[model samples]
Target: MDSLAGLVHGFSAAAQPEFLLYALFGVLVGTAVGVLPGIGPAMTLALLMPITYQLEPTAAIIVFAGIYYGGMYGGSTTSILLNTPGESASIVTALEGNLMAKAGRGAAALATAAIGSFVAGTIATMALTLAAPGLAEVAVRLGPVDYVAVMVVAFLTVGALLGASVLRGLAALGLGLIIGLVGVDGISGQSRYTFGLPVLGDGIDVVLVAVGLFAVGEGLYVASRLRHDPPELIKIGANRMSREDVGRSWPSWLRGTMIGFPIGTIPAGGADLATFLSYAAERKLAKGKRRAEFGNGAIEGVAGPEAANNAAAAGVLVPLLTLGLPTTATAAMMVAAFQRYQIAPGPQLFAENSALVWTLIASLYIGNVMLLVLNLPLVGIWVTILQIPRPYLYAGILLFAALGAFAVNFTPADVFLLLVIGLIGFFMRRYGYPVAPMVVGLILGPIFERQLRRALAIAEGDPLTLISSPFAVLVYAALVIIFVVSAWLRRRRSAASV
Candidate 1:
């Protein structure tokens, strides 16, 4: 009953003229960026941080939340039409979506993806509304040692789950931790890793890292792959789904949401894993003809994973809101946004700023509706984004990347750093290393250090205090179990291949 009233209040707040306008603007921009090949929600939010610094807190959050969800809706468009995935989460969508397009069912594929995203997002947002407050209640009781344990689990999962190789994920995480450790020590006044550079004292801006890696690096990588041969675009002949299509997809949407929401709430439950799990689930559940369509362009393939992707997106918000843990790149960027407004999202957030939290939650429902409306009949319009020439598109992206970097402090040094980081990002991509763990590592490393220091301080410099609590012990045990299981599976797979 309390959750119901809270949602009603949130809806009332979200319905305000100013909030509605920001919600609309956010989804629009978010969908547009999602349609673009190189930019993901994290990069888009980072690029827009300068503008958000000038807005009211509620409006800024509404907008950022919209973009985060809207990007999920927009990614399927490129995947189905161009066989190019805008985000790693959408990669599964392309496997079946592009095949559907090739089979002249492009419209159905897009329709299912857009609609499935709506169903999953709406259901998952409701789950978030009901679950977040309760989770925050539980989280409030946890001590600093427990929180540190949670962070460790998050660190382990981020490194283990994101990419093809666990070693590479750990390597990327190590790099991020190194970057995060630079600059003046927060607890002590001593400078660290400054290399005699004045700007290093403030540490590198998360915005610069996000933009350089996602936008600039992506542009360079795409530009390198540009050839004289024009890519083929699958045409959307009929944009309507058959009655059978509707029947087939609705159940998958629900199941995918079921699979996605719970996993997303976990500290390491990323969309990449959620989508894959949803795909595998759907494949396993299908019978005869439907099962055979797994390799073909099956509508179920598009529906289930896309639904899982969106649900997982909503699930990412749960931990972000309740525990102040960011499981996804966009969620990590949002933490920076909260810090910018002098607000921290955690257990205390609900007690201190309940209205803003509810309003942000309310806007998600509105954003989901807006994305469906914008994507459905207007499929042709969104696909037109793909028509832009690579040279021009990439050049514009690089220009904006530079502009966004300079906007941080109007510093030429930041721009130089952006270029250097962009080059590093390009190589990371070229080598098949996942970029997200690096970002996650940089964001979480400082938090981990802060908690570690506090824990030791409370324990009078006893290192054992970290794993002393029952909760801490359980978390560490889980981490070790996961690491061992993952390694065993990898070795088994390797041996079978041999």
Candidate 2:
């Protein structure tokens, strides 16, 4: 009953005209970025930081949440139509999504993705609403050592799970740690890697790195590949799914929601993992004609994974809101945004900013409905966006990338730094290194170090004190189990292939 009243109050707060406008704006921008290759929600949110910083805290978060959902929805369009998954989570969707497009059921594929996202998003958001308070209460009692252990687990899992090779993921993480360590030491009051440059004294801005890597680097790569022929686009046919299609998708959507929400709540459970798991589960569950259609145009393929992707996105917010822990790059950027307003997220958030938290939650419900409507009826419009000329598209992207970077501090040096970082990002992409681990590492590196140091300081500099607590011990044990299981699975898969 308390939860019901709080939700009702939240709906009232979020229904304000201005808040609704912000939500709409966020969804539109998020969809645009998601449809464009290489520009994910993290970069879009980072680039918009300057603009969104001026807004009220609740409003800013509402917009950011909208962008988060919009980006997830928009990625399915590109994955099905272009065979280019906009978000890594959508990669599993493309496994059969593009084939569905080729088979002329592109409309059905897209419908399933859009509706599944809505169903899963709504279910997961409700789960977040009910579970977040309990999680926050648990998080409030955790000690610094436990937090350090949690960070270590997150770091190890993110590094291990993201890229094709664990070595590559670790390498990217190391680079991020180095980049994060560039600024003045918060504890020691000493500059570390300024290189005598005044700009470097403040350290590299997270926004600059995100823009350079996600926007400028992608623009440059796209420009280089402009000479290649564009992929053939499938024309829109029936947008409505048949009764059979609807029946097949609903169960998969429910299962995906069940699978995704719990995984997302975990420190290492990301959208990519959830989507792949959902896909595998769906494939296993399918029988008869559906089983034969796995390699062909399978509607279940698009429905299940897309649902899981959106659900996992919602799950990430649970940790971010309840514990102030960011589980994804997008969540990391959101932490930066929250810090900009000096509104720390955690147990205190609900106590001090209950209105803001509740309103944000309610707005998510509204945004999900909005995204479903926008994605379904107007998909043709989004597809037409693909017809945009590459030269102009990339040129505009470069312009915005430069402008967004410069807007950070109104300094020319930021522009130069963006270019340098862009070049680095290009090479990283060329070499098959994943950008996400590096981004995650850069964001979490400082938090991990700070927690570890604090834990040690309290224990009189004993390193073993970091895991003395039962909670810390449990976290470490989980990390070890994850590593062992992952290694064994890899070995078995290799043996089977051979």
Candidate 3:
């Protein structure tokens, strides 16, 4: 009943003309960025961060949230039409979607993706609405030690889950932590890694790192791999689904949402994992006749992964709102947005700014409906965007990256830092390091440091106090179990190979 009342109040706030306009604007820009190959929601949000400072807090956040989900909706269009995936989460969709397109069923593939996204997004938003407040209530009671434990959990989970290898993930995380420590020490009032450089005194901006790693690095990588053969654009002959298509896809959408949303809400269970799990689930559930279509452009393949992607996107917001813990790179950028607005997201955010929280939740549902409407009839338009020359598109993105970096501080030194970081980002990508963990490490490192200092102060420099609290002990135990299991699994795989 309380949840119901809260949602109703939230709708009232979201329904305001101003907030609705921001939501619409956000989705429109988000879709555009998502349609462009190699650009994901995190980069898009980071690029727009400077401009958002001019808007009201509610309006800016609404737009950011809209972009988060809208990017998921638009990511599928590129994978299906151009055989290019805009986001990693959409790669699974391309396996089946592009094949369906080649078979002259592009329309049905796109339609199923759009409809499945709507269904999954709607259900997942409702789950977030109901789950967030309860989580926030519990989070508010946590001590500094517990907070440190939570940060450790985030670090371990994200490090273990994102990369192809655990060592690579930890290395990326360590790099981020090192970058994060470059600025002035908050407590000691002394320089750490600045090395007499004034620009390094403030530490590197998160936006610069985000844009460089995702936008610049990804763009350069794609440019380097660009082929002389022009991408074959798939035509959408009939943008409608048949009854048979509907029958094939409806169950997959439901199953994918069921598989995705729960996993997404858990820490480190991001859209990539959710979509992969959903694809595996759908493949396993297939029987004798349908099993053959698993790799050859089945409608179920497109529908299920698309549903899972959107569902996981919604699920990721649960922790962001309740505990202020960002589960994905995009969520971390959103946290950065909150800090920009001087609005901290956590238990205090809900207590003092309930209207903002509720309104943002309501806008998610509205945005989901808007995405369905925009994606369905506008599929042809978005596909047409891919017809633009790759050289021009990438050049424009680089220009935006430069402009956004300059906007942050108007300093020439910042521009220099941007180029330096972009080079680092390029090497990181070439080495197959997971960029998300680096960003998470940079963003959370400071918070973790603060909590550690506070906890030590409370215990008179007794480091053991970190594990003295019951909650902290439990969290550390869970971390140990995760590490042990991961090691055992690696050993088992090694033995099997031998």
Candidate 4:
């Protein structure tokens, strides 16, 4: 009842004229960026985080939340019309969506994707609204050792499950941990890795690292792969769907929502696995004729995976808001955004900032509606956005990245650091190293360290105390279960692919 009342108040607050405009702007920009090749929401949020530093917290939160959802919606458009998916979660969408486009059913494909996203996203946000508060309440009772256990789960899952290989992911995470430990220790007042530089006294700003790795690094990498001619985008023909298409799509949307939301809430991984699972499930459930269409351009293939992708996106927010754990790269950037506003997203967040949290939640509902309205009517605009020249697009990305980095403290040093980190990011990508674990590590390392120290201090430095609590034991046990299950899932998926 209290949560419902708070949500009502949040709707009232979020419905204010100014806030509505911010939501519109965020969705517009987010959809635009999501349509562009090689630019994901993580990079867009990183670029915007520094730029949004001066806005009121509520407004910024609304905008970020809009981008979060809008990007999820827009990626389907790219996967369908363009040569490749803008993000990995959309890879499954591309498999069927692109086929649909080539087969001249692009309109039906896009329609189902847009509508499925709306359905799944709306349902999943409702789930988030109800679930987050209860989780926070339960999380409030947790001890430092429990938090340490949770962070360990976060570290292992994000590093091992997200990328091409576990070793590379762990290596990237180590790099981030090293960068995060550069400044003077808050408790001990001693710097560990500053290398005796005056600038090291303050530590490297997260804004620089984020903007550098995502925006600058992505820009440079894309630039290296730029072609002389723009890749052709499939024309989206009369954007409408048949009644038969609707019947085919609705069940998949619901099934995908069920599959995606639960996967999202857990620390197992992000939307990629959820999408694949949904795709496989839909293929299995299809009847004789529909099964024949699976590899070509089945509407179910376009609908279910897209729905799963969006639902998983909503699910990723659960751990982020309630426990301050980021399962996805974008969630990590969101944590950085919260930290910039001096807001931490753990259990205390609800009691301390109920209004803000509820408002953010409500705005998600509003954003879903806005995304559906915006995406359908403006398909032409998105097609134009997709056709943007690689050179100019990348140049603008780097320029915007530089400006955002410089705005961190308006210091040249920040810009220089941005470039240096960007170069490293380019190398990381070039060598197939995952950057997400690095960002997650950079953001969560200090919190993990703090919790570990407190847990040890309370135990008089006895390491065995780490697993003494029942909750901590459950968490660690869950980690082992997740690893074993994930390994089996991988092998099964590989066999199916073969």
The TM-scores of all predictions, comma-separated, are: 0.95, 0.94, 0.94, 0.99
Best by lDDT: 4
lDDT of 2 by residue, 196-307 (tens): 8899998888788878877777668657755656657776555568999999999999999998888888765488878877887998899998999998878998999999
Tens digits of per-residue lDDT, candidate 4, 1-91, equal 9999999999999999999999998888888878887898999999888789889999998999888888888888889988488788888
Off by over 4 Å in 3: 480-498
Clashing pairs in 4: none
Q: Comparing candidate 1 with candidate 3, which one achieves the higher lDDT? A: 1
Off by over 4 Å in 4: none
What local lDDT does model 4 show for residue 270?
A: 83
Question: What is candidate 2's local distance difference test score?
Answer: 0.85
Candidate 3 lDDT by residue in tens digits, 318-348: 8788777787889989988988887877778
Residue 203 displacement in candidate 1 (angstroms): 1.8
Q: In candidate 2, which residue pairs get closer than 3 Å at backbone N, Cα or C atoms, i.e. clash?
A: none
Query: For model 4, what is the alpha-carbon lDDT of residue 451?
Result: 93
For candidate 1, the lDDT comes to 0.86
Name the lDDT value of residue 224 in candidate 1.
93
Clash totals in order: 0, 0, 0, 0
Native-referenced Cα lDDT, model 3: 0.85
